[model samples]
Target: MKTNYQREITKHIETNQLSYLFIMILFIVGLIFGAMIVVSMHFTQKQDLLFYLNQYFSRIDQQEILNHFDLFKSALFSHLQYLIIFLLLGLSIIGLPIIWVTIFIKGTFIGFSVGFFVYQYGFSGLLFISAAILPQNLIVIPVYLFAATIAMIFSGQLLKKLSGRRFIRFTVEPVSQYLIVFVVLFGFCLLAALIEGYLIGYYLPLVRQLIN
Candidate 1:
């Protein structure tokens, strides 16, 4: 059964290779654009951002105990909202462009975050991000990318059906399978939220010490 599932997944990717490539490239383009935005920021703008970051760090230091549960709830809620958008967009035939925009925006935020860290503290910035950001994003990034890709693919399928280009495989999998995939993806999002909430909170103090 596992073998059959793997084969089906492999076949699915093979069939949608072009869509995956296009989505991946779109995300990369967003990342580059985000980095460029960092480079182009005015000195004052950079300082303002840096000031805010410092204030955040100071709060973390001053607090005797962080509310990790609150962090988990916030992260999970954000992930849920993002996934809900993809789910709705996947159901709509006109959602293709919006799905692309969503992926790009996600990439842009990630790129901007890493760019800001590296720009501010050099190697220490890299260390801080690796500890603070990369842990959760290691799962979160792929989850978003896969969700976006599948959403686009499903949207495309809906378009084909509307255009009278129906295929047997479309009928075979149907909306149920598409929805199942999103549900499974959401489970991964849950794991990412845990990492974001608990693991990152644990790591931040260490990262703060290293950077300081």
Candidate 2:
């Protein structure tokens, strides 16, 4: 049986399903755009990227000792930085477009990375991506998308109030709810960081072999 809190949350989701769908489509479009850009890269550009990528992998190979703590810190800090930005963006009307851009850019970068990996190393690259990238992103991406969607909805509410929509009061209730949701999302970010920092090392040998 669902508690009242769960019921309310479900109702809210049902009400905002269209917004979620729209944001998801936007992210997917960005991903496709990124992959397409990879396809269109000039040979010289690809070579430059390949050179850097090989250098990076070589460094990692040489440094066989991985610092799990440092990786965790890096991943957690990165997630928190973006979450803070979304929090600020949700506070104002002009931030809606910026939030959209942030989400799109995130998707684009991920797509481009995956595309480049597969382009360069064939099946091995795909395996590396599945092992190293997907595990963390399986949690991270949804958390971010949820944050972006919530930010969008909050900003929309502010816009409504600004436009003299009397029924939609810009009250403490929404603000508190927004903060609470992000706080919960932050916990998920920590889980993602753990995966990125610790879980990926389990596949270290495979990743190194693929890169080389």
List, residue by residue over 55-114, the lDDT tens digit for candidate 2: 877767776546778888999999999999999999989999999999999989998999
**Candidate 1 local distance difference test against the native:** 0.87
Model 2 pairs in collision? none
Per-residue lDDT of 1-212 in model 1, one digit per residue for the tens?
56988999999999999988998899999999898889999999999999998888888898654688888999999999999999999999999999999999988988898898888788998988888888888888888888889999889878877888545344656788988988998999999989888888776777787567
The 0-to-1 C-alpha lDDT of every candidate, in the order given, reads 0.87, 0.88
Per-model TM-score versus the true fold: 0.93, 0.94
Off by over 4 Å in 1: 165-173
Show pairs that collide, candidate 1: none
**Candidate 2 RMSD to the correct structure:** 1.7
| Among all candidates shown, the one with the greatest lDDT | 2
Taking all chains together, the TM-score of candidate 2 against the true structure is 0.94
